[model samples]
Target: MFTSTTIGDLYQIILTNTLICALEDLTTRLNKYKLTACNSDNVENEFTALLENNIRSSCLPIGVENFDGDLAAFFVIENVEKMILKPWGAKNLSLESISLGQYKNEIAAITIKLEDQRRRLTPKLYY
Candidate 1:
């Protein structure tokens, strides 16, 4: 039986789901840790590690043999640094609570670029 799905559709679906999973994992980690000044010393490294790990894991299900290893790493590090510098007063707020929206936007943009790349690779016949 023929299916309605095209390669572009498949690519988008896989990319979206993978990013969603990664975001969910990041959120869980943030909630668990409750980002605070106490952890500030290692937050950059820790956030970068968490984001990079999630992104790499997400790539596995999409059949990506090779990806720019530093793509997410660069963004995560930059954003986390910015977050740390922000004057968010009243210490009880979780880092995730303060930063999740920005992080979500970053992840969405990255996912879009991935989808665009995939589209370019299969141009003329799809997407």
Candidate 2:
């Protein structure tokens, strides 16, 4: 039987799609702004900055906090997917089993705690 996707999976898909769209849009904007032919470092810097700004503007409305934005921006600048795809050891073991566990608890705890802090820290914005 084809069970429906869980909400978590759905949200992940949404976020991943959003990030992919942002990556594409940023590239287009960079081209328009004449950064397309620039050095790689400059291009990466601009993309990271643009990602940071977009997270502040677009993602804040959708409930993503400044920290999440910063983390996501870092991931984009780091080419996290590419890093993940690269072979890690002699046997070419998959990376997810190692890294996902570290992130799962840490990210969940931080997001939850920081969300509480965020609400308390700036009640006006939240309210």
- The top-ranked prediction according to TM-score is 1
Worst window of 10 by summed lDDT in candidate 1: 1-10
Off by over 4 Å in 2: 1-98, 124-127
Q: Per-residue error at 101 for model 1, in Å?
A: 2.3
Candidate 1 Cα lDDT to native: 0.38
Off by over 4 Å in 1: 1-33, 37-98, 123-127
Q: Residue 84's C-alpha lDDT in candidate 1?
A: 30
TM-score of each: 0.28, 0.24
Kindly report the root-mean-square deviation of model 1 from the true structure over all alpha carbons.
Answer: 14.2
Candidate 2 lDDT over 12-121, as tens digits, reads 42343343344444334323331123333454454445444554321111332211322221122233311111111222211222233343344445455645664566
Clashes of each: 0, 0
Clash count for candidate 1 is 0
Write down the worst ten-residue block by lDDT for model 2. Answer: 81-90
* Cα lDDT of model 1 by residue, 2-104, tens digit: 1221112233334544554554454454344333232555665554464544554221112322222222211133335223321113222123222445554
